[model samples]
Target: MRVAVVVMETSHHRDTEGRRHIERLAATLNEAGHEVSVFCAQWWGGNASRFEPDEVTYRGVTVEPAETSFCTRLPALLAKYRPDVVHAFPTPSSVLRAANAGAKLARAPLVVEWFGDHEESVSARAIGTANQFVTPSELVQTELWEAGADSDLTTVIPESIDMDLVRDVVPAEEVDVVYAHPLDDSANIESLFLGLAELRQKGWSATVIGDGPERDTYERAAADLRIDDRVDFVGSCDRERRLAIYKGAQVFVQTAWREHFATELLWALACGCIAVVEYQAESSAHELVEHRDRAFRVTTPQEIADSIVASADMDRRTVDESLAEYDHAAVVEQYEALYERLVDEYGLF
Candidate 1:
């Protein structure tokens, strides 16, 4: 299978969760024995039109990350590549429109990876061009529906984690609570801080993992609440360190206001942390806790505080066997199945 992934900006040009997700998917498909080529504005320092770093081949549609120029060149490049499937990112929307033309020219099925980060109006128009749409969560699917996407054409595929590492890594020192997310304006870490502040008289330690523009603001909020001493702001640790902490921690608190899909929360749950998700309209965090044991969904700091206290009575776990379905290989199989189904429908085999 030859897959052509279309994203105007590679992660190297602009690092974002959406870009990272698509790039990771391309690599995973490559490892699964598919011939994957990423079409984007060149991020490498050279005049070469193609760069093969690792197994995936990255074809430069433009010399630089100029949105208009890349969009103009994409259709011709993708038509020339002649992939079995054209997987595209739904951001600028123009790129999706361009990729649609390319998919038609190449006679390939177009699948849009809609991350739900763009404005609803633009996203609706962007999704209209694709044969199928893949969202990381139903929250995004619903958003796209409201944006004018056909429900029949869309599918939800959750992010995957390394369950092997979950089973193998030794736990870090135990703590009562753990919260991890980039401390951006939308982080909502203050909610966790206020929740923790309510239990100041109680004996507990919390670790806040990750860093961003608002890290100091959140740290100061912790100080203002007088819980700074107990809450450690451990900035931006790697996945293994996070998994170790999740394994050691009793509860994982998710208070981010805007998450297309709560990836860190998924990792925490697979590692066996009792999930306490604060409901936010834009976040899909609560979806992860649906009908699941040892998970609480709440909307306030008081409720989060109460849930934290209540989780102590629940049985401790090092790993949840139920989450094995979300392992990396399993999720990749879902992608493969989707690709095969599309190809069969198009009679491209």
Candidate 2:
């Protein structure tokens, strides 16, 4: 199938987890024997591979950037590269935008893919443009429903990670936890600091991976919490190095306030770290725990510390098995089938 993926920026632009997820999906679709193209936002700086004003090739696909939101530039994009099916990302905006873009450009089916609640508001124009809506997990699907979507509008899909980077590494006994994400708003780093302070009282050390605007917030929180000496925020890490960091840790922690499907959590699980997720009712982290027993969840500072302490006794092989369900190949097959079904049903080219 010739597919056009609509996304907002990528890791090629800035160090963002959402961007990385989009890149990973595009790469996977490319590997799954589809002729893929990406339409994304242009990152202003941060050393993205130099390309044309509007379109450029990054990784394997042709990535086109629209200057404004969907309203202005989409028609111009549709006039350029026509695709068979549309795979949209970054929640409601890109999905809505791509739906309009597809209407003008190609006679193709549209699948709206939401990474999280960032796309909470989908208008009639957006839904009218696409036939299929996919979310990373049931929790996200539920959110979509709550946001006035028609019943059964969303299908839950697991977010896949590159298992190659996660395999065969000796987890560092010295690193008790790995916090790999940009320390920012939705990440809820304050909760992490509070949890770590509690953990530190019991003699735990952690390595904070990734960088963002909120780094100083965490830096201060760590010190104010009196756990600064026990924490290390390593800037941005490459895939292998990040996985190596995960493999070396005894536990992997995510305190994000929101999540659709956390690829890094899957990486941590593949590496055999007991996954400690901060809980919220409308979160994929909770749904993932329901699907896999290897992960533990809690909301309060005490709950995290208790879960962390209890997780030290969990088996490694079991964690490895839990991560097996989310391998890219398995998830891609589901996507391909969905694509085929959508195309067949809608008579998309």
**Among these predicted structures, which one has the highest lDDT?**
1
User: What TM value does model 2 have?
Assistant: 0.79
lDDT of 2 by residue, 1-349 (tens): 7777766555655545455666677778877777676665654444463333323333212234443454365555644566767777634454466545654567667787765645256565565555777877777777767766665557877888666545655445457777877566777777767777776648778899878798888788889988889888888888777777777788888887766677677778787777788886545666656555667777787788887788777654412655666788888988888888887877734
Q: How many clashes show up per model? A: 0, 4
lDDT of 2 at 47: 49
User: Residue 77 in model 2: shift from native, Å?
Assistant: 7.1
Give the top-scoring candidate (TM-score).
1
TM-score, cand. 1: 0.95
Give each model's whole-structure lDDT: 0.90, 0.68
Name model 2 segments beyond 4 Å from true. Answer: 7-20, 39-82, 90-105, 117-121, 168-173, 199-201, 315-319
**Backbone clash tally (model 2):** 4
**Native-to-model Cα distance after best TM-score fit, residue 139 in candidate 1, in Å:** 1.0
Evaluated against the true structure, the overall lDDT of model 1 is 0.90
| Clash pairs detected, candidate 1 | none
Per-residue lDDT value at 245 in model 1:
95
